[model samples]
Target: MIRGLQLSLNKTQKLRLESALEQLESLSSKTNTNASVAVADTIPVNYEDGVLKGHGTSEMEGQVVATVCGVVERVNKLVYVRALRARYKPEVGDIIVGRVIEVAPKRWRLEINFSQDAVLMLSSMNLPDGIQRRRTATDELNMRTIFEENDVVCAEVRGFQHDGSLHLQARSQKYGKLDRGQLLRISPYLVKRRKQHFHHLDQYGVDLILGCNGFIWVGEHVEAKDDMVVDQTNKSEQQNANSGGSVGSDDQEQSHTSLEIRQNICRIANAVRVLSALGFMVTVEVITEIVDLSSSLNLDIHEMLGAEFYVVVAEREAERRRSSTKKR
Candidate 1:
């Protein structure tokens, strides 16, 4: 019911959008009968069964009430409301994308769209040396070398401390500073937890990270380089020739990304933006479908955000949900 997008719809476009939304609402009504409630609204529950309240629900004046605007859910005796547009609630082992806000004494504080800033300690992450050695004063001093302020990073939740602050860790090669990418934010509820969040589109040559916290990253895929292999190669070269020295040459130019790859990244990113604007569930399958639809219609990347395309997407999503309901 939350429509955040503002489009200048004409008479025909407005009518089409209304019809599509009505169809979508009717389809959802048939599948789910869960009552939606606003803040401070009393939820009807049989107290004789001894209900256990969960998140977003609080007892007020001996009556069960909701503290957020969302749908009511009951799992046996436990009841809770799934908030639609709330801050990210991190769980252990969940992948997240955050920006480095500050470099502290022994930790890096990140603004991860949570209630509080999450902490990433120096000891919890892998160093550039890729060694498991203890973090000394030198390593602490060189914290900025790993992740500087304003750097976008990918990490995993490492549970919470006793002080109720979120902690993060990046121990694997797959987790580290992310560069050459665009980060897009959406409602955290739109992203559902899944087994795989890191997606590499082979055809487009792009990498997409669908963070559970609703921080989506779309960028060029960079291969993970192993520090240990580089170290071993350096040692082998030194043993072969004691006169081996590093060459310093500034003639090499940086390779620019191809135009096709850049276009693909923008197209995919715009697809995600359009989907989020429509308040639809953001899934890889749905996103891919939208991208394919745009391509099949010969719509430019910029045109995908136009009013006409928005109406078409809404109607397509309505049809998709209707078919899904029928299958159910």
Candidate 2:
């Protein structure tokens, strides 16, 4: 009936329609908060009223819904993730990978990648039981035999102390004494965002643990027979070949070898830095790729971390000198 002309709404009808549209929009957008005031007239409220304060679940209210980017979980209100993933704050009964930096009579001091060093008490550990219990004078003398400085270890965060420092324990079957392996240190944030602890490289015969303290262990799943002998021989050969340079030693041979190593290391570090910046979780394959690239550049892997490692940068300076020579 009203073909050519439109039927205009009264003021009340227009208001009702506007309110209905606002509710519909809110419903469609999944905005849970109830709007008490008129939809259009209501001032915008901060949307991030529920974000987590730190990195994990908070008892505190109004936390934003920020979950860990990678595979992670909150178990019994405790958060855990893999290495090189983002990290939540530490909680009691958390297992962590740590390094021994200091040793004392009753407890050892450990670097667990937290703000403070954790204490590993002698009593908390499952040592030889009663009477045969307590470390003897001989055992105390050989503290290095039991645990040495720079020894990367795995332990559990038992609880906190009155002073707020963490207490650690290695009293489980899975915990304790790691043998020959390569250890890597990374940022803690990367660990909190991952799900698993160990990533098995079965084909490579390698087993790795991404420690919460940024320490990762990479080595053969099973200890290699005679690996110590092989390592020893290799070390001896390298040292013997590098020995004794007398006055004005052109050192050109050593310099060349060292430069090669530094070049490879720098390239790898650069690649890792790039990937890390891009939020890519670093893996052994990533490192291997960098090494492969270095090989393509004619770099020697054997020279990596060797005595001549510093010479690469030096050679760069030397090249500058040569260019200046040409200019002169």
Number of colliding residue pairs in each model: 0, 17
What is the number of residue pairs that collide in model 1?
A: 0
lDDT of 1 by residue, 1-328 (tens): 3377778999999999999999998888877885899999999999999999999999999999999999999999999998988999999999999999999999999989999999999999986656578999998997886789999999999999999999999998788888766899988899999999989888888899999899999888876654555675564554334222211121122236778888888988999999999888998889889999999999999999999999999999999988887787
Candidate 1: stretches off by over 4 Å: 225-255
Model 1 residue 74 CA deviation in Å: 0.8
TM-score of each: 0.90, 0.45
State which candidate has the highest lDDT. Answer: 1
Query: What lDDT would candidate 2 get against the real structure?
Result: 0.51
Candidate 2 per-residue lDDT, tens place, 19-114, comes to 544444444345334322221122222444422233322232443232333323334433422222433246776667778899888778987767
